[model samples]
Target: MDSSLIQRGRDRGYLHADEVMAAFPHAEDDIASLDEFYLTLEEQGIEIRDEEESDEHPVPETPPSLLGRRLGSHAHRADPDDSLSSVS
Candidate 1:
């Protein structure tokens, strides 16, 4: 497990020590201590950028809900040729 990645998540306030440990169970033994991990982050000059700080575009609007209502009806219909009367 990369302690740096965990530290980054912690700095971003998205994760806590317990959550980090849960994600990387084996890391518990590998990491000397949580305090040490923080100290390392400080030494590395790593900082978490706020979500708003990043350039993000708005999500597109979803399709119309009425499309879902037609799905069942469409599936039950027969083929066009089968629905037509015998011409010969």
Candidate 2:
């Protein structure tokens, strides 16, 4: 599954049926595959809601992962003075 799509679903707490269909084109032809995809989404905490529902919720920024945090610490150590304010 595409991480971006997964993130989108996560941010919204739901995904349009069409979006899910597009993500798993094979599901269109295979009922079993579609069922499995739905199961996967449920496991991931995403819901399949109607597309008519207005998209009012703002997309939340994705936080850095633990690995990213570790790498970021190393980068800061390598350049202790490098900060956003220093970028001119």
Candidate 3:
């Protein structure tokens, strides 16, 4: 799986250690931890998906879009934002 996608899943509470390990088999090659994943997402400006309302783990529908992922019961990728990392 894509790092960005894995990051989003973790952010959305969908990533367990095994899930993360399974999602990105190559994470051991570079990424060190889930926190590191968040750090990279912050540095790379990737949007983390929300799971409160969205279950699909939707990604930004558009390329390089800044709208962030809008996940209703129907999840749809719009654009990404830096705000996701700050959420509690």
Candidate 4:
């Protein structure tokens, strides 16, 4: 795995140290947040990578809630072939 990915994983809340330590049984208690690890890597002259493939694709934040409770409701409507079909 790339150091940048490890740093990014740590920076984001995705990687839980205590959970990992508990699961692995051999993991150490000494742990640092992603941001902290990033600093250490930077001091070592490690290059930061942009994981995103392109700048055009924006990262989603709002989530799919705005789409309503059911995602395929419209598609499952009576007139499935017609885009104008409405699902109750």
Candidate 5:
């Protein structure tokens, strides 16, 4: 297990399960080793995400209603005569 790989994972805040498995192939079939690997990752501040959770669609931190409120607030700053401003 290279420290650089762990550092990169920490910097990105996450690594897919496959990435971890690929980096530490010996841990694959050993349940104890796998658990220790996960703990080490957690200690290093790296989140382990399943490959199914692709980066293409990141989870939104803000809820939709809160997002709407933020956009609405910005809309109020737009010119009253702006055509888009008339939209509800």
Candidate 6:
């Protein structure tokens, strides 16, 4: 089972641990692991929300792009003729 799908389901309030286990019986062990992982994240003060509560939290905005500046920056690559073998 893809953890991301489980996460998305949780995000959308459509899936939970029981549903995941039923859908992917082979992932039983992983369900416990995922629960523990979520717990750890909560312990560290990260917020994990169920679908009902997801709407209450605002999604973070994307950071401004640096691509323009990066593209404008100059860089130099070594020329093949500059190699010691070429000189010799």
Q: Candidate 1, residues 1-88: lDDT per residue as tens digits?
A: 4676756665653434454455557665767665565565556665434446433545856567855675756657666777446756
The collision pairs in model 3 are 61-77, 67-79, 68-79, 68-80
RMSD of each: 12.8, 11.7, 18.2, 13.5, 6.7, 14.2
Best by TM-score: 5
Off by over 4 Å in 3: 1-32, 52-88
lDDT of 5 by residue, 1-88 (tens): 4577678787888888788778768774677867876788889788888877646676659887787787875665656578965689
- TM-scores of all models? 0.26, 0.49, 0.26, 0.22, 0.52, 0.28
Instruction: Give per-residue CA lDDT, model 6, range 1-88, as digits (tens).
Output: 3557546655664444444455556555667766765565455454544547644757755555864555454646567668676654
Q: Which pairs of residues clash in candidate 6, taking residues 3 or more apart in a chain or in different chains?
A: none
lDDT of 6 at 20: 46
- Positional deviation of 18 in candidate 5, in angstroms? 0.9
CA lDDT of each prediction against the hidden true structure: 0.56, 0.76, 0.55, 0.47, 0.76, 0.55
lDDT of 2 by residue, 1-88 (tens): 5578778988978889888878777765788767876777899999887766745666866576765765664664446777899878
Cα lDDT, model 4, residue 72: 52
Rank candidates by TM-score, best first: 5, 2, 6, 3, 1, 4
